[model samples]
Target: PDFSHRLAEYAAALSTRLVDLRRTLAEQRPDTYLPDLATSLNNQSVRLAALGQTEQALQAITEAVDLYRTLAEQRPDTYLPDLATSLNNQ
Candidate 1:
């Protein structure tokens, strides 16, 4: 139990760093990096959920869902499934 908690904590920290990096990249080249940022956010949500941080998890997934929604509008074929996944995650 202790090891699992520690692992979750470490994962959450790593996910936060990854999200920050992806967010910056996305800002620099939105067309190319938005999907990456969304993916990172989705992954971060999962890690946060594992740590039992429900509110933070919800916030991360909500942002991911919004990002996926915008992407889906551009390419539903590719992003609708992701949007659905993010919604489910939320």
Candidate 2:
């Protein structure tokens, strides 16, 4: 149970970091970091889900889905499945 609690805590921290990363992405003048932040956010979402923090996972992944869907519309081959997976997790 300690491990589960620790995992939840870790997930919470990761979720917070993802939120910070999103903010950083928006605030950055250069767009080069956006994709990396998006990818990191996606990974954090998956980790939260794996930790059973479903609500946090859903929120993070929903953001990811939005990002991926936008990208997918521009280039389906690249981001469509990423979008689908995020949506499927819902």
For every model shown, what is its TM-score relative to the native structure? 0.96, 0.66
Clashing pairs in model 2?
Answer: none
Q: Where does candidate 2 stray beyond 4 Å?
A: 29-31, 50-52
- Give stretches of model 1 more than 4 Å off: none
Q: Residues 1-90, candidate 1, lDDT per residue (tens digit)?
A: 698898889989999999999999999999999999999999999999888898999999999999999999999999999999999988
Best by TM-score: 1
Which residue pairs come into collision in candidate 1?
none
lDDT of 2 by residue, 1-90 (tens): 698778777876866776687768756732555455556667777777777778877787777777777777877997778777767765
RMSD of each: 0.9, 2.8
